[model samples]
Target: MEEELVQQSSSTWPPPPPFWQAFTPENIARIEKSRQQQAEREGVEDASNVRLHDLPRELRALQPPLEPADGEWRVFGDKYRLVDELPKLEDMQIRRLFPNPEDRDRDGKHFDRALILKRLAKSLLLNFLELMGLFAINPEAAQDKITDIRDMFINFHHLINEYRPHQARESLISMMQAQLDRTRAETNAIRDAKDKTERIMEGLGSLKFGDELVGDSTPQKDPWATQREVWASALADIS
Candidate 1:
């Protein structure tokens, strides 16, 4: 058999460079110089596009001072005045009282509720009046107007239900009753007109128009009978 030889590579290899080699002063200086150049370029670009007149006062005050700082003291010649700081006691007390931000928001909510109530009150009153046929010039047309008024009241009540204000509910109930009263009055007036018309027709039916050709055909018993009948009918209808 031929002689066999085994070759082994050495376990020790040359040590890697030191950690600080890559971060040498020369490399750090090169990086800083590049950063400064980039910053200067950006500054020049911004200055070219920016309008001095549009710049805020605070930003305009960012110019370098005429003299540099000497040790720890600043050598700027700007007018500097020392003003006493506001006392923190009141601020602390306020913060303690209103720990939650919602307290301020509650005031806003209350004002909004007041506004909503005012608007609802106005709308309810207007609707009530319209329903009662108070706008009708002729009292004879009051009966037909009652239905319209009733429907409007129903709609108003539904609207009030949605608002659901316990405090104002009583006031609304009183207003609704007033509307009912007005509607009742209108219905009575319509009945009175009908009764008057009926009385005139009745008196006419009893008289003979042709027989009175030579005499007075007009009935001369009581001049206020028709008026009295109208009043009685109106009272009965209202009751």
Candidate 2:
């Protein structure tokens, strides 16, 4: 039986390596080095095949020039500060609260988030207005503009959603404050009602309506005395 098992193990298509040899540092290093080399070769090939012009205009702008600038570009030097110069939007200025990190460059250059939002807003409004005009002229032609308007609105909302956490926190604070105010108002109302009831009770206590009965000489008859006597007589008779 042992001989048969040995033959079966030896006849396996690919024998597993000895456990001690499999986990050796040298073997692991060799495997890792080969993988790194393969990755490098693939990266080089990918880089060589991709051209600058093939990239989108927005992506191309992110690429640095091959040559360094001759002079520093900071015209304002130490005088320049990273301050938000954009005009505040309605009540919640999310752009100011949570500015996009990618929008600002190391050179202190920053694209205006306010301007981007304004442009999107303007585009959405104008497109909707145009669609309305088109609908008035010809409803069939307006359908195409509606898609454009919808896309613009979606883009605008998508940008707004980026600062959703800040908006959500603000909304939560406002709601909590409203609830606290309402609770306080209700408490005050209850307190006022209690005070009013206490005052009414005090006023009723001082009235002279029942005072005259305290001093009256008239004796009131006990209605339940006769019923108790009858019950006692019936019990006697039963006994």
Candidate 3:
């Protein structure tokens, strides 16, 4: 059954890579070359793997800084360069950061703020690139760049902080406008209710009560008025 399944799969048009022209003369030659190169690399690595401690002191020693007079200490010592040596950034990367040339201009007042931010970004990238390699070669020099990076970050945040007052004012204005709209709606509702009440009172005034009950000649006192008078008499007795 497994043999039948294998046959069925292999019969498809365009077999998988491992089965497609795998045993061709060109493929076999390529595979042999790859294996030979891999073996050569392994042999080279094994030959080069020497124990550092076993080597003579002179072979494993760094030259005295003073003897070189301006070389060894500068390369591998506790010295820092006064000016930063920045790595070159590609033109494409720079264009992606600031596409418009006018944005790079610092003289214009309107573009000045953006110009500073772009320059800060450029400085950060340069320092980051230098620090990547400098940390392994010179940690102190790498740490020096960190201070500038931090200052630039702080300046960026300061620029952002300038928008706080504007944001707060906009929020307050939006809240007050919403409150005013609600108050106006409430006022309109109350005015509508007053108008409806006045209309109902005018309708009631137009009706003639005497015409509706003409057969009854005697006048009757209102029950609510009698009840009020009784209450007033009870209060007078209490007094």
- Show model 1 residue runs off by greater than 4 Å: 1-164, 212-239
Error of 2 at 152 (Å): 7.0
Clashes of each: 1, 0, 0
lDDT of 3 by residue, 135-156 (tens): 8898877766776666667666
Model 3 segments more than 4 A misplaced: 1-108, 111-133, 136-138, 199-239
Candidate 1, residues 123-171, lDDT tens digits: the string is 5576566646555666666665565445444444443443456647878
Candidate 2, residue 73: CA error in Å? 47
lDDT of candidate model 3 versus the reference: 0.60
Top model by lDDT, which number? 2
- How big is the positional error of residue 4 in model 2, measured in Å on the Cα after superposition? 59
Q: What is the lDDT of candidate 2?
A: 0.62
What TM-score, computed on C-alpha atoms, does each candidate reach? 0.21, 0.32, 0.33
lDDT of 2 by residue, 93-197 (tens): 223322445546756867565677898887877888888888788999987787677666655665666567778899999999999999999999999999999
Q: How far is 94's C-alpha from truth in model 3 (Å)?
A: 25
How well does candidate 1 score on lDDT at residue 82?
40
